[model samples]
Target: MGKRLAIAGVTGAVGQEFLQILDQRDFAFDSIKMLASKRSAGKKVTFKGKEYTIEELTEDSFGDVDIALFSCGGSRTKEFGPAAVKAGAVVVDNSSAYRMDPEVPLVVPEINAEAMKQHKGIIANPNCSTIIAIVPVWPLHKANPVKRMVVSTYQAASGAGMAAMRELEQQARQVLNGEEVTCDALKYQLAFNCYNHDSQTAPNGYNAEEMKMVNETRKIFDCPDIGISATCVRIPTLRAHCESINLEFESPITPDEVRELLSTAPGVTVMDDPENNRHPMPTDASGKDDVFVGRIRQDESVPDNCGINIWVAGDQIRKGAALNAVQIAEKLL
Candidate 1:
């Protein structure tokens, strides 16, 4: 009720999620502006049960906005984030543009909420893949300094954008209609299929998403020397992402100790029981705020009992993007 806010890329997936979280939390805001690309301009969007017309994002869109959540893309954030700051609005950008900038804070509230206070007008939410990995890993990293990690992420098609989600849905429909599967939003048919390839394949084989998990994890944990390896795969799921994480620490870390530490950790739901065939699943985590972690056990591959294997999941659009950005904005206030 005191401040005005604007959701850039309001028509986009992350932007819509931001609006939903704000409404769900009953955030007190006097005014809400929804900004989107010109193509989506003049479209109608409803916030807090009120109909509002979406405006095309321009250099002047941030006027009188107290906070602007940017999720359009990195290029858009890089182009307009500073302008929003100049217009007197704090920007919580859900992109990689300013994440590695030494001046801009890349925050995951549980791991680095205090960093929000040091923002240079813009705070960055970590990458979706990184966000999911860190939720369950941070508490462990805090208790024991992680020496290294090797992770493989099974991401959702929705990570690409709403188009990818639609493509998967439409493709499945096509298959159901007895037609050939389409592969427009992805490199391969994502309808009831899985690809063990990176989000953006590199010459060396690792994808951009794979690198984000490695780089962003080190930055969030403040452990640049930690040896991190990652392989990111895209799955047919609509929303949530799953990660198989193997962490190695300086000392021998135990599964029991992890269970104790994570049992009450903030925003974490520990659901492990390999023998019972219980573990974190995307279906279970979808539309949820907390990150679900399970399959906790020691890894025999890493020596000294210093390694543990686990699986984790969370809604990439929520915790991995919108929710985290909103949480940071809340911290700013």
Candidate 2:
């Protein structure tokens, strides 16, 4: 029999992708419950040719649910997660609420499906940038133990949410028409501009988004000692995120060897062809399930062929958040 499922925050961007991914993957579910905040309670959403009314997420929402995919922000997860667990439903939360919890497993199914086996009723999904970065990094790590990694990210407005995406479009049009740009979803104009990600600056001079890459990467890799540093920026792309990774391995590693490792890695695709200026880009990765990888070359600054640089891109909403949460649910089945 198919499992009974509940999707929290059904009115948000990731929630919408959750619906699309479920339909695309044909996830077996006997029934689904659409849930949202009180303001969006009566909204209508279509899934698998059937209409589902968005119901207010309350303490009583998970009575018959076997699994719940949560895309609501951290606050909601903190408020309602325990209730869902008490009601006997496993939760795959796509928020920062329970991610660092010692007992909760932070999972990216492609990299660590076994972590989900230890879930105590709730499992946390890693941050979007971490997910896109780690998918390709894990294979290389397995091949040659990585000593350190430095990453710079070009994140899309979609990572902020739907409001930011709509603002990007409006700002671009306003700029083309030579009008003053008004900022709502962000503090500055995103059209014809780029800025550091706005995910709350921390005391250590790193923003929350950048720190997520550092902390979550370690937790997911189960290598707390691995050295990692990240600089995250928000670009004007509508969807998909890109990253440039510099890896230093314990032993000498070559570009050709790294390519061979990633070629067969799950959820990764190579697009390296510098001769023709062909490589992974946000335009190509949008709406795709695989993380596109390219620009595999040696980092000349480091000696002994120990450093390799790579460029990669992936759909943040699909692989980063919603699809990852859904994949964890699939493992439960």
Candidate 3:
């Protein structure tokens, strides 16, 4: 018999991606369990031509389960994640609930698969932006440490949830029809616009998502003293999210060397050629799993060839959330 796996929040966007990735990756599993909140219980989800019924999450949910992939949210993970771990199940949690815990390994497999080996039971998937950023940056850091970075993110509505995607479509039609634009999934209309902050309200003036990038990157990169600042904005797109990154290395670097590092980095596609007006964009990356990097150049304003500017894009729902969670499961297996 193969491993038995349980998925919490099995009906949500990330859950659906988990199913897709598992099927695509051909992971071996003897049985699959679907779990959700009581409000979503009794629903049927189809995967690999088999229908699985979702049950409400409970303390005994991990019985006989070897792995649990959690995306229900932070609160649920906080309340139930430990219980699952205590029940002899390894948890690959995709929430803010445990990523920062020193005891929990905040992992991005490409960047730090070794961290997974250190897992006592729970391994946290870093924030989507953090995961994507580190995928390209970690490889560079291996050659030399990064001392400072300033990033501005153009995130997608899907990061907020499925409702945000729907809102973007509906609101776009309303705008086309000249109807009054109403905000629901996000505080402001998400279509054809951008914001400097992540959520509508940011406690202490730091958007929650921005704070995640600044903080999570530090932990995943294992650099506590690195100077990092970020601004995460919700763009109108429905799937892929992008970021404009400016990084300063601890030592001098050349564009050629930077290109060499990223060109061959696993799970990263370096598509830079500014003369050809080529760069990674959300539309080109909406469905891709690899983090696309382009627009590579030395930031002339910042000292040395050490300063670099690049664009990054990835399927926020896939690598950002579900795909990453599933990858951890595959590693555990």
Candidate 4:
């Protein structure tokens, strides 16, 4: 029998993407419940030629659900996740609510699907940037044992949600038409301008977004000692995120070897072609499932050839969030 699926936050960007991914992947579901906040209840959404009325999400919403794909914000998840679990549904949450909890499994299915066995009714999705950066890194790490990683993320407006994406589009037109730029969805102007992530700055000077990449990488890799430093910035792109990653391995690993390792890695697509200067870009990665990887080269700063640099891009809303959660739900079946 097919499982009963519930999509929480159905009106939001990631929520809508969840619906698209489920169809694209042909996920088996006997029934699907479209849930959202009270403000969005009763709205109609059509999926696979069937129309589903958005229902108000509450503690009672999960009684018949077998798997709940939660793209709701952290607060909503905190209020309702346990209720869903208590009602006999497994939650694959995209919020940060349960990510660092020692008992909850922080999963990237491509890297560690086995960890799902430890879930106490809920599986936490890693941060978008972390997901994008680590998909291609895991294969190399398994072969050479990455000792450290230095990452700089060029995130898209999609990370901040649909409002931010609309703001970017509006700002772009206003700028080109000589209208005053407005800043509401984001603290600063995001059209043709990049800025540090708007997440709160921690005492250590790293913002929450950067720290999420640092902390979540260690947790997902199951190596509490792995050294990771990240600098996160929001770029003007509408979707997909790009990262420049420098890796230092325990033993010498060449760029070619890294390429060979990632070539067959699940969820990775290598696009390195220096002759044509073709490489991974957000434009190519938007709405794509696989992370595009390229610009493979040796990092000259580190001696013994133990260091290498690569660039990657992936859709933040697809593989990074909705698709990842849905993939975890697939394992449950």
**Candidates' lDDT values, in order?**
0.88, 0.94, 0.86, 0.95
- How big is the positional error of residue 179 in model 3, measured in Å on the Cα after superposition? 0.8
Tens-digit per-residue lDDT, 174-282, candidate 4: 9999999999887899998999999999999999999999889899999999999999999999889999999999999898999999999999999999999999999
TM-score-wise, the better of 2 and 3 is: 2
In order of appearance, the predictions have TM-scores of 0.96, 0.99, 0.96, 0.99
186-259: candidate 3 lDDT, tens digit per residue: 77877777765545346577777877888888888788888888888778888888888898998888778889
Q: Ranking by lDDT, best first? A: 4, 2, 1, 3
Could you tell me the lDDT of residue 277 within candidate 3? 94
Per-residue accuracy of model 2 over 146-250 as CA lDDT, tens digit each? 889999999999998899999999999999999999999877899999999887899999999988998998999999999998999999998899999999999
Q: State candidate 1's TM-score.
A: 0.96
Candidate 3 wrongly placed segments (more than 4 Å)? 198-204
Clashes of each: 2, 0, 0, 0
| lDDT string, candidate 1, 173-259, tens digits | 998899998787677888877887635677877778877877788888888998889988888899999999889998998999999
Better of 2 and 4 by lDDT: 4
Candidate 3, residue 191: lDDT:
72
Poorest 10 consecutive residues of model 4 by lDDT?
183-192
Off by over 4 Å in 4: none
How high a TM-score does candidate 4 get? 0.99
